[model samples]
Target: MGAWSRLKEAFTREANISSPEDLLAQARGMRNGKVPVTKDTALRNSAVWACLRLRADLMSSFPIDVYRYVNGIQIEVPKPPVLVSPGGTEVGMREWMYSTEFDLDRGGNCFGVITERSGVIGPDGRGLPGRIELVELGAVAIRGNGSTITKFIINGAEYDPWEVWHEKQYTVAGVPLGLSPVAYAAWVIEETLSAQQFARDWFAGGAVPLAELKNNAKVVNAKDARVARDQFRAAVDDSGLFVHGMDWEYKPIQAVASQSAFIEARQYGASEIARFFGCPGDLIDVAVSGSSITYASMTQRNLQFLIMNLGPAVGRREDAFSRRLVSGPRFVKFNTDALLRMDPEARARTIGARITNRTLAPSEARALDNLPPFTEDQLSEFDRLFGSRSVPAQPTTAVPGATP
Candidate 1:
């Protein structure tokens, strides 16, 4: 096909998701003619952005490691240049992971153009993505059936499956495209956004539903009432007080309730957003209600978060990185210990316990504290202070019918 034909085809192709419906159909109650929930629009909702931000920050904080198993022990493998700089730019893997993770958290998918491939090939003769050039989700058009991607059209340029790097979450069994959280949860997000916008407009336009100056005791003529109304409105418009006589009373109908309900809706929406992102409401300051539960310390809270909220997502990322970044038995993993690090006193206690249990060594524990190995003088001091611990050998048992 000609360039124009390819461009037209790229623009005309149907959406990548299954069920073959309009992207915003699930959000039928969306305002302004049921507008679609793009990433930009969804991000305008603070709660949505907060959830995505929380996930992205945590995921990016982890350092990725490539290792191989030897006799069931993980042996650290030197990271290739590609792993260090996946973008083929000065941008390191951490920034790349952050951006891609943010995209995945918001849209359930991330796409990038492969700028270079390594000589080390993976399965199916497709080389590892040596350098990926990240692309905006808006600029990439995925053409495929529900289960498998056929071709990628990025900015009207065609690319094979191996030429692009795609990481997806919220996946279904038969769908090629990941189900977007923003799309599926659009109803809640749009409702929250609409409420926020309404509040802004209400304040900006100075439109009150209950601004009538009612006479409590005395009856006022229509002319006087109109005069009073005009005066009150003019004063309010000028950012002044609506001064009136004691006989007149101004009552608001559900005005306070309306504001309170909006606040409540925001809190509820925040909780829902935290849920959708698999985060603890408290972690994102969503303020869970009426709970007596408490953690002993921040470490416990982080432990709970790692176990219940972030573990599975981290595992999925490890799987993706293992499959795409390397071939053979070598795999990728995130150093999860960073998330569960304890305070200094607690850390010393834990490390001491491990040393007592013989599961850890003094040199290794020193490494955990970023300390160099003990010098001869330091070792002599320790040996002097605490007597040298010499192991006692067990008595040998002579075999009855065999030579000892």
Candidate 2:
């Protein structure tokens, strides 16, 4: 085959679909309230919600990977874009971007296009940021012959012009592996899970224990804090085979913007946390110049405490991503400023005390030293807060029936 022929194989959409009988069975199940109810359906519902409000917002569009975080974990799978009608017109498959932003003063153009996942959620509890969807009347694949195909996906299945040629073998340069959405999702999920597991293990003292901490006290300067975060994040990257952070930041804005507390924290703190934890990237400052930088938002007070406490131990947690989606920095600034707002004398006294004492109080030191190792229980709130005993109730969602 020529290069053009090879290109055709890799650049087309394909899927496994239910037959007429299968469709009828599914519809009947729906009517009977017995539709299998797999995680896939829940995910699809979540994805749909994320893409709903993209009618005309610009800047960052939703990517398909937005639906990756389901069930208290970051899922890294990709799904076909859910093309939809912006004006509710019946244009079958046309061209469209995921979001557009307009101001009477600024003029409206499409700003966000959902291409790949990056960790935002939809209103219905699905990750929506970094998601890309086909416009309601969108044409996805255009051939050199001036022909185009309409594409859409649901429940990890894709639909397109390729459906007519489903039986044809898909090959590229003598490689004959065909394309299918389920296969893609499976591969992506497996890879994502592996990386996540690796991150969890690496941070739990499995990588390199800071021997100095065992002998001396845990010393933390501003620079030391930065380095400690980086070292922990490095363990996460050592896996070398998994992907992360694609939709970690994008989903909540368009999909589930209601997470006010989480939204603030992520904008202020999570990014910093990600950086502090070892992102090896530029330090994202909470305050740049004078006013607080909006992007450096923070999570709720209690949640921030938990994340700061556990992050060095747990490589990554699903809650971090969700909270990050809606985070902003105002609340954190208030809390921080309030504490330091003490009178100059009190401030001097505090500073003098710290300068004089080389160590923390016994209780404070014990609290720091007794921090637990990473355990599935620690990840799940059902575990104890202090001791290794069991706790009541599984981790439930803030909203009932939210994608867990």
Error of 1 at 386 (Å): 4.0
lDDT of 1 by residue, 223-327 (tens): 988888888889989987777677788875556778899999988888887777777888777889998888998889998889997888899989988888888
What tens-digit string does per-residue lDDT give for candidate 2 at 107-197?
1111123344335444445544443332311112222221123443333345543221111112224222222212222222233333344
Highest lDDT among the candidates is held by which one? 1
Local distance difference test, candidate 1: 0.73
- Evaluate model 2: give its TM-score: 0.17
Q: What is the C-alpha RMSD of each candidate to the true structure, in Å?
A: 8.3, 29.2
Candidate No. with top TM-score: 1
